[model samples]
Target: MKDKFEFAHGEASVIQLKDISASGRARLLDMAFARLRFSLFVMPVVSVVFVWYYGKINEDYRVLIWSALYCCAALVTFLILRLYREDQKKQSSEWLLITWLPRIQLVAAFHGLGLMVLLPMVSHTATIEFKYLFTLTLAAIVAGNATHQAPMLSVFNCFLIFSWHCTVLLMPWSFSSHWQFIMPLSVLYGIGMFKHALTSHRFFVRMIWLEEEGSRLAENFKLAKNAAETALSDKNQFLTTASHDLRQPMQAMGFLIESIIRRNIDAGLKRSLDDLKQSVRLATQMFNSLLDLSRIEAGAVDIKLRPVNLNSLIDDIALIFREEAVNRNLDLRTWNRKEKVFVIADETLLRQSITNLMHNALRYTKKGKILIATRVRGSCWEVGVWDTGMGVAIDDKEHIYSPFFRNEHAWRIDSAGHGLGLAVVARSAKFMNATYGFTSSEGRGSHFWLRLPAANSIDFSPQGLAVNNLFEEIKDFSRLTGSCLIIDDDPHVCVAWESLLWSWGVRTKCAPSGALALAVIQAGFQPQVIFCDQRLRSGESGFDVLRSLLHLYPEAHGAMISGEFNSRELEHAESEGYLVLHKPLEPDQLYAILSRWLQLKQN
Candidate 1:
């Protein structure tokens, strides 16, 4: 066998040192082999054409021998190529280099000696026109070899040798004594073609290397995308667990504080209790804002749309912030037309958006009254919170809506502010299909507004507004008369629920698990309302516990209380027609549930 393709000269150092992979080498072989197979069939016709052209005029049978030898060479290359293809399927592509490289060199030999050298010796073309015509045919064949054989220089050089053979011997035989003058030009053209093939070979190898590099980069990008998604999922889970743990105690303390403030105590102590209550509410706002931003980033915020009464919503928000506004020596006021304005929006998201605006207004405004106003526009309602204090600078306006972004001026006033309040507002407005913007002058004040689409109350009753908004108002809890079933794993949380419900004249049967709650039912304690906490210590969610109890008491009202804002269980509870209340539990929300039960009982 002949030496390998690497024996060819005029290649770059990288390719000569085996830098071209086995697959790259195989691709080159595939292209060359395809051309060889096609040429084998065409060469027989070429031999026929050669014998037909010269044999009629010249009385030479030697031409037939040359044609026979050329056809034989084609036939031998065809048989070996077919055998190579059959075995190539079962073997690695590297076999093309180890086994087929030597065969390709032999294929070149057939074109050189078997066809080129024998052409001039046997076929005597007396006419100069036909002699040049034969030379043109050989030159065309030389050009075709450059296309297929350029991948391997060893094979390319072998095929290229024929052009020199024509220049040195065949052309001279055809031209007679006139050959010496034309010989130099033919040799120069032959040398140019040889150099061109070397460049083409380098280009082919460079393309193969790039293909391998691109494939590796694509795989790495895919792995990185998967890893980022997994890390985001893990972060969401950790936040959910930690939020629930911290909210359990916060919920219990809120209940205990509300229970204390309800009793007849000294005026001085009652004022102190009210102050502490305002402090808790402020802390709850900050915690909820941060958690909300995290949930939105994790793609866990699923906004639910519904009809919301702007009048009732504004009233509730005014009540929540009024206490803090008083402590800050600022007048907190709300104004709207006596008419009950309705809007199509997600009540939860709308409430948060407005609350963030209100909280932001309160944080910046140290003096002057804060006004929460609602206005009717064409096809929409605009609710705005106007405050008078240190207003935003012109440059800070653009980035104010971004999460955790605070300017130097505002940071000095409220060092504890996380800047998430306005960010939550922006996201909540987008999710609810509402729009919000602000107008502010530095050191004067800011007026932030949220606009929502006007919705007709014909689809839903106007009187049912209070029934829908669980956080509306803290009415006379003495009116709440119903038996409550509380399911929670934390002992402090259960006690807080019991004390708060008892104060509201709600008879309660508390249990730590679903099985124990069933035991209470077995003992003949029927409940009118069931309040279950999500993420129980028994590995059963509030939805799982309430599912069994709700089936047993179809007519009874049931609700889920949990601090997790983004959870499948929270979504599942709401889907099953149960009201899902997030912690720390609001006194007004529980009262809303109990009030509905009392109405049902009385009817």
Candidate 2:
């Protein structure tokens, strides 16, 4: 019983293997059929040529017999082409192996049989010619059919067996001394052709499979790319909206804090308020830095290049950091050749880059001094920040400029540092076409530097500064009085503007939209200065509002303010001759601009 069960199990395994092989061949038949069409077309032409040449040389009735056979073969080949074309339209693989492939094998068999029959008829007068013609015809058929037909090994083997038998039978066995050699060589050639056909078939199948897979992968990649782009666009839009909405409340808080600090309060209360102000300032700085990095990543930061005075720029940086350095008990200093050094660069970007470097230096250094200086290095000026701090290790140096990448020492020193300062500096420096690098020795110090092309001749006339001096030359807002209009969708921002401007002794009115601003102007309230938010409610923009208001009040000086850093809006505002400000606006900066506008109106 055990021996009988083993025999039954072996029979079942053989049957299963046969079924698997049949299914695999069925899957490949469609591709093989397509390749067979090329060989079919070539076979008819070769057949007709051989018949015509044989007929011309012999001038016998055998020409007509062979010509009829060739015609029959041509008709079958034409029918096969037609049938395959029709089958391809349906894309049905069901009947391909059983029906179409057999028909193709029948045509190949007919060609082989026709060649064998033609050989004996021409053997008498056309011995050498028959040998040459038969060999060439056999070679052409083998070469042409092998790649397409070899996928079905049984069909290929059938054709090869018939062709080799025909060639061996045609050899001059009775008289030729080399018949033995010739017969063996012909059999070997047939075996070699079979081997070559198997290789070509496998290569063809592999290449076709790869082509199909590659096409699928390409389609998937396209879909992924589109999805990623859409996500990025949505993220940028969210950032823009969030920045605007968040800054409105922050602007209000800043204005309220400044107004309270300016009041005559108790010394203790004033000190507490000062601390609160510092906290607010720090929050504002971090928020702005985050937004700046976002804008840089979103490709929204525009570079506006102009001649800048290195001395004046360095002086401003020192002034800004002077108090901070004092609080830290660190000396912040600048060094340069006594004369003014000039460079053509985007002043805002250059300043931001240098300032970020300065902030980074201050953040890292504990007790040692920080130096902001410039020196001529060949044809370029190297503006650098040298800090006596715990310098970065070699392992950490490469990643120090990457966003949110901090060394263990840095995290220990200040966990609050977002590690964005150097990243901003790197991006800004790149945007301005400047090369930035750093040299550091662990536990001693680090020197971060930016190399900018130096201007040969100085333009004595100073460039228009983004923000004018407020403390040294405090404008008398009390001496000047004018009506100012504030158009912003955010009520908190409008209230903040009103509170600050009213305290400066200027008459102020606020509107939420372009239509509302137009109504206010139509009511015969013409303001001397107009402050418009870049984005208003109800699908309105500051540009439209400004245009409508300006039509009524042409002499009013217009300024655009926004929390979002959109390069398009900035470019438009700049082109339209509007002063641009980002929020939460600095009290000194706002006062400086307002004082200047009010004084100009009075003048």
Candidate 3:
């Protein structure tokens, strides 16, 4: 049984009073009480008809009195039942006894014997017509009680017994020839209906038990759903906190290393430092990608759809990630780089998607070559990431894009990954309305591709534009002279940021909090750019810090820097036209922003 009602073993052969759960039994009793309301109305009316029809010929005042008395009893029962249903309903749940038998036999006796008394009263001094009237009415009242009140088995049996006693007391031949047949037939009707009431009572109780059971299950399901949501929320919070903690040190290391590598250091030491910096940067990237997957799913990522230079975008990605491939001692090569490709895309989403693909290839590939290439397909251009990594098994192919789901072979290779790389790719591809697919042999390797519609506006060659961009970039970077303010509670972060900005030909001041940043502004320091951390150790918000600093210097271009990739604060800022940047900010990304700000200042 999927769900079995707790039924106690008792003396009764047919559905014992104790043979069900307390709540189940209470539900059955509630139905019995409801049916009593209808019975109260019917019984009074039955008495009225009996008195009106018989009073004309007999002129019996006693019958009228009895009728009045019965009607009054019904009225009183109606009021009591109504009050119980409305006010005492909570108490009634406890009325299901240890055996689930109610203590309402007194009430049942009063109602049933009230109808029973009428039959005997009429049969004694009445004609055959009056006798027929009383007998038929008594039969109807008994049948009605059996049909509705059968769940209360003890009450219904009392009703039948009282009626049977009346029939036996008037056993002699007092009926007309036409009505003589009804006397014996009433006994048989009672027997048949008695058996029916027994069967029906059990079924009625079973149905009530099932209904209560279903309600209990629904409540349980609701609690489980709430618990699951809370757990998922906690998991996300834990990841966010962990990411924030890890990024603080990485940000310091990133800035300090970049600052050191900028000097004329030995080539061998510079190369080693480069490797360490790349490792920290990639670790931060992986965590950000995981957060990115969540943002795409939540519909939080803003799609900046535009005509993007595919060749330029891929080359930039290739440049940033090539160090990882070199560290892995793997051949990382790009093909058709000069095809001068262009496509309609969200650059961030497309870049993240391709980066994840390349990351997966790097993480899994132990030997051979990994190829990042472009192929012109029918009506679309496909970017493919091919590798000689361990491929997905035939069985695991279907769930390859599932978050945190990893196959045995893949887990064996890289257990550190939460298996979110492909998930990010799938979600990004879906959001961009692009088609992505993959092919792999279990032992050999895998090839993943994202196919995007080729842009119609491919008039200018990216190579010429690339040359002009290089010249403009160097000029922008070299002329990067401005006063910048950085607000962060971490001491190392503040010092490192100051070092990196000062090296970029920009005068900088780093504050441990918003108040300090304000103090710096008040001390005659006017900043052109502001970078504030979202969460500070002093519990002050980056937004609050920016507002205060900007109030002092309204012309400053401020942005919130956070380890959280898609935090609600950053999303709100982005939507409101404020700039937001992620933590462990790559030198180029920060320099690019500063370069643009400088160019704007010059213009």
Candidate 4:
């Protein structure tokens, strides 16, 4: 799965190969196998030589007995080696170490020096035959060291000492002269080999275990690293979605409170409420900026490019803040060269970018005027937002598009922003494949421009559907309203939305759960509009509820409200022609949606 091994469906199941362990046990076992193979090759040659030497000497029966014993030992050693080979084919390293190591060592030792003990007994018939026994003893010692590890070597040497003792005691007077010296040497060699074998066995066992542990640790660390990365990614995504969704309701609340305070007809109360509303709005904006950055980083924002009218868009911008501009005695004007500038772009995203620039300009500007203009320049039209505000220094220009970076002037003037507005604008420009730049003079003004390639021929033709302030239609929603079903698990959200809707003269039926909403529907409470939250307390989501309701009330307009901007939700809602309201809804935003819905219902 990780591009390590490309295994077929059944390959892994059938071929259960050993995984490499950090321990040297596997290597040690391989070395032991090699030694056995070499011993097997030498065994027959030595056996035949002993048989030939005995036959040529015309020795007594004793020599024949020694030769026969040597042959039998060699044959048994060879059989053991063959058995070991077969076992190696089936046994894993762990199995070999635990079950076969001790047995193999003892067998190898016995065969290695067993015949050498019978050598002195044949001296009466032929001393030459006794010389052959010594040669066989030396060979066994060497072969034992090579094939079987430590314990086997020790056994080999110990058996050689024991056999040599028996041979010396049985020796005839003619060969008894050197028996004492020969017996001691044999015992010393055997004891030394056994000691060394013991040491080797312990070392191999330790090394093997260490290898296994190292491999397991490596695997665990890899898994932990992947999990940490995944967690961080999810955290960033959650923060982004939460911020965006929270902004809508917060912005709506701010606007509504501001509007209510403005109509207070008392200057003191109006000022207080306005301040409160401004604080709320600023908080909402900061959260929205954070959300935007998160969404962009998560690769969740998708631009829906469509043919949009530049003039109409500019008009909408002007209308959104015309009152605020007028209130501050700042002139807001649009200079669109009397031709239609249509572009292939995401209308909402384009609006956001332009609005951010406008808002940023307005925030710093205490003065003369702000201008928005669009004109064809070569194959693209440059749409500009110019403001007489505290402009950027040349040094700070590049960094303005960096998130959380505020210029010295901006910090001195208004440091409230998350400093992500220009960054979002820049990312949007890149996403749309549009070019954007700014010309600014410190203490004088700044002009930000976006260049979008024209889509279709520029049509200056005007349409009557244009309204001066689309937001104005929202305030008049109370005049014509019907029963609205509110679905959300959060009681606070339900209460707030109901309060807002009641002012619009709408009768409300509320359900805290999707199942309850279904029960309400079954109880003959068919509302004209439905608002549902995306996540419910249980595993059920707003979509699940909407689907169920749609089956029963096909004509009922269902809208999903959430604190997340999921692509799946957007696409599904778009296909169904359902409105998606993100959280912290602004009155104007809510109004805009309601007005549109009301118009659709009328149609």
**Pairs clashing in candidate 1?**
none
- Which 10-residue span in candidate 2 carries the lowest summed lDDT? 1-10
Candidate 4 lDDT over residue span 1-603, tens digit each: 000222243454221113334124446655554564455456556656655666677545654565566566567766866787787788776776666657655654554445444454545565554474654555464536533643223333434444443444454443566656655665565556555555555454444544665777888888898887688688776685455445545644654574465346877786687567656744564555566556656677655555677877787677677888998889999898676668766655677789898888888898889999998879887889999988888889888789888877677777788798898789888888889999999889999989988877532121111111122223234343677888776666666666666666567788988889888978988787787877777668678787778777788777777667665864586567566655555565566566555543342
Model 1: CA > 4 A from native = 1-21, 119-131, 162-180, 206-214, 228-250, 253-303, 309-342, 348-374, 382-451, 455-470, 473-485, 495-509, 514-529, 539-558, 562-579, 595-603
Candidate 1: global Cα-lDDT? 0.75
lDDT of every predicted structure (CA atoms): 0.75, 0.71, 0.71, 0.64
Which sections of candidate 3 miss by over 4 Å? 1-27, 34-104, 110-144, 164-199, 223-246, 257-275, 293-373, 376-430, 433-489, 498-580, 591-603
In the order shown, the candidates' Cα RMSDs to the true structure are 8.5, 9.8, 9.1, 13.1
Write one digit per residue (lDDT tens) for candidate 1, span 1-603: 121223233653344416657877888777766665566657778878767877676867666787787678778877887788886887887776788878877777666655566446643544565566666776677667676677776776877775455545566666776688766777776777777767677667666766876887888888888888888778877877799897888778878887887773688897798778766765665566567657767877666566777888787689888889999999999998787787888766787788888888898888998999999878889999999989889898899899899999887888988989998888888888888899998988888998999877523221222234524445445546668899998999888888887777778889999999999998998998888888888988679889899899988877787788767877676655567777876676566656756653342
- Model 3 agreement with the true structure over 199-312: per-residue lDDT tens digits: 667668767655766887898998998888777666666666666777788778878877776653698896787777666656655555576545554455557555666776
Candidate 4's C-alpha runs over 4 A off are: 1-41, 49-71, 74-102, 115-207, 222-491, 498-559, 564-570, 584-603
The Cα error of candidate 1 at residue 153, in Å, is 3.7
Each model's TM-score, in the order given? 0.66, 0.60, 0.59, 0.48
lDDT of 4 at 349: 64
Write the residue-wise lDDT of candidate 2 on 1-603 in tens digits: 000111132253212212323335554565554555555556557666766777667777775677666667667777877877787566555555667667766655665666566656666656565556677677767766676676555556556656656667666742155567677777777778877776765554444444555776899999998898788777877887788887888778877777676653688897788778766755665576566656666777556555677777777678778899999999888898787787767766787788889888898899889999999888989999999998989999889899999988888998878988898788878878889999999998899999998877643221233432212223243434889999988877778777777766678899998888878888988898898888777788787777778777788877778787665866677776667777877666677677666773444
Collision count for each candidate, in order: 0, 0, 2, 16
Evaluate model 4: give its TM-score: 0.48
TM-score of 2: 0.60
Give the Cα RMSD of candidate 2.
Answer: 9.8
**Model 3 shows how many backbone clashes?**
2
